[model samples]
Target: MRNREETYGLIVETAYKMFAENGFDKTSLAMIAKEVGISKPAIYYYFDSKEKLIDFLFDEICKEIMDQYAFTVEDLTVNNFEQYLLTIGFQMIEEQEKDVHFNKIFNEYILLATRKERYMKQLNKIQKGYFESFSMLMNHGVTIGAINQENVESKSNMLAMVIDNIGNFILTGLELDYKGIWKEAVKSVLLSVRND
Candidate 1:
């Protein structure tokens, strides 16, 4: 079972790299199998089809991001909101820097989601989950006198949008200093909701 899990992870990672380099439409299951040093049947044993693999990859990435968010906001407080935002922003920047191919593949998935109804549905569902989590955090802040009780829903939505856009910008290879820009953007959001 452990080996199966490891092989599954390897196949997903290799397929993402190939997709990043050659694109999803251009990448084939045989190529992924070859890259992972596995037989085509082995690959099929794990994933029924390329589309299933893509969906699995998307879900896995979403789970990881959500897990990170949960950890980041575990001890949420108004005083620490800025620090937390900065921490997450920098962490995302570092992640993108660590593997340009992953960023490219993620960006490509975003683009593909826009053109495909099924992919777009999945993306939207994930985004809605993010918005809900952010909204809950802001509502908690309001209850604790950390944030002003003014349009918490809208404020959360705005914050989520800003964060998502910053990520998209970074993934698309923006030339500016994204870390600095993200800090400023997060600061702005925090200031906008401060109880003071």
Candidate 2:
């Protein structure tokens, strides 16, 4: 005798686990229904189609991570820009390690986004938000004389790439010194534009 909300939440949770472990390609409505102890039609009651479910998960992932890292440029000192990059990099690694299921689903969505218009819009909105934040931070750095204004957009793009991919180190469970590597990357990409 579950309410609609409980059943819907249960479906999402079960689907996330199944997709993360078995992959999205192999998962089917029948499989999800079997796992959730619901009929296939029951799943349709919550999600019209698999695509809609993926869309829902995409939003879920976006909301889950986008809520973090909300900081004003005024709160950040230009001198701490390198540490800022490190914080973003470390956060990615920590998050991926904390929930491999979430990380796997995120990667799957990234691949799907390439071919789906809806996913592209969602992904673009998320990335645009991050790009704007990085660009503004770099602009602030330049204003404070910590960095130059040259190539602000390109530099922001590079930093955003680093933040997005630094989580791979944890995904691979690599034993190398990732912090050392990230520090080198930050110095090369960002500190290279220092005004001083």
Candidate 3:
């Protein structure tokens, strides 16, 4: 049973890599099976279909991001929301760097419209939840004099959009300087909110 579970993990990881390298639409079960050194029938033992495999990969990545975000924000206090924002963004960038396939999969999701309406709806909800969570933190910052209270939601959304766009830029193109871009965006946001 342990070996069976390990093999399943391997198949999932291999399929994730293949899907990352190739877009979701282009990745086929046969291709993933070949890459994993398994017969197509063996692949079926793990995932019923290519769509299911993709869904599993998407769920895995989102779970990882949320877990990492939770850990990163665990010690954060509301007084320094700007710092926390930068810390969380940079931590996400760091975690993302550890896996190239993760970026590919993430980029694919941002670029591709899901054929499954439920997944598409869930995606929007997840994105909005993240934005709202950060905005609430920023609102706390207002009470503590860390952020401007005026138009808090709009400003929070704008700040979050900067991070999101920078992430997309880094993941989609190798020519871009990801580290520098991430740092610059964080710095820019901090400067905008600084009491000075």
Best by TM-score: 3
Provide the lDDT at 127 for model 1: 76
Return the TM-score for each candidate structure.
Answer: 0.78, 0.78, 0.80
- Superpose all Cα atoms of candidate 3 onto the true structure and report the RMSD in Å to 1 decimal: 3.2
TM-score pick, better of 2 and 3: 3
**lDDT for each residue of candidate 2 in 1-196, tens digit (9 for 90 to 100):** 9889988999999989888878889998789989988899889999989877877887888897676545466656666766776776677666766787876777788888788888788878888888887777778777776666777778777877776666765666677766676677667656656534
Summarize candidate 1's per-residue lDDT along 1-196 as a digit string, tens digits.
4498899889988987898888888999999999898889889999999999988887777777777556335577767766766787688778777777866777778898888887788768777788887788777767756667777788778777777777667666767787888777666656755536
State the local distance difference test value for candidate 2. Answer: 0.76
Which is superior by lDDT, 1 or 2? 1
Over 99-166, each residue of candidate 3 has an lDDT whose tens digit, in order, gives 66776787677665455675676678667776876676667666666666777787668767766666
User: What's the candidate order when arranged by decreasing TM-score?
Assistant: 3, 2, 1
In order, what lDDT does every prediction score? 0.77, 0.76, 0.70
The residue ranges of model 2 lying beyond 4 angstroms of the native Cα positions read: 1-3, 189-195
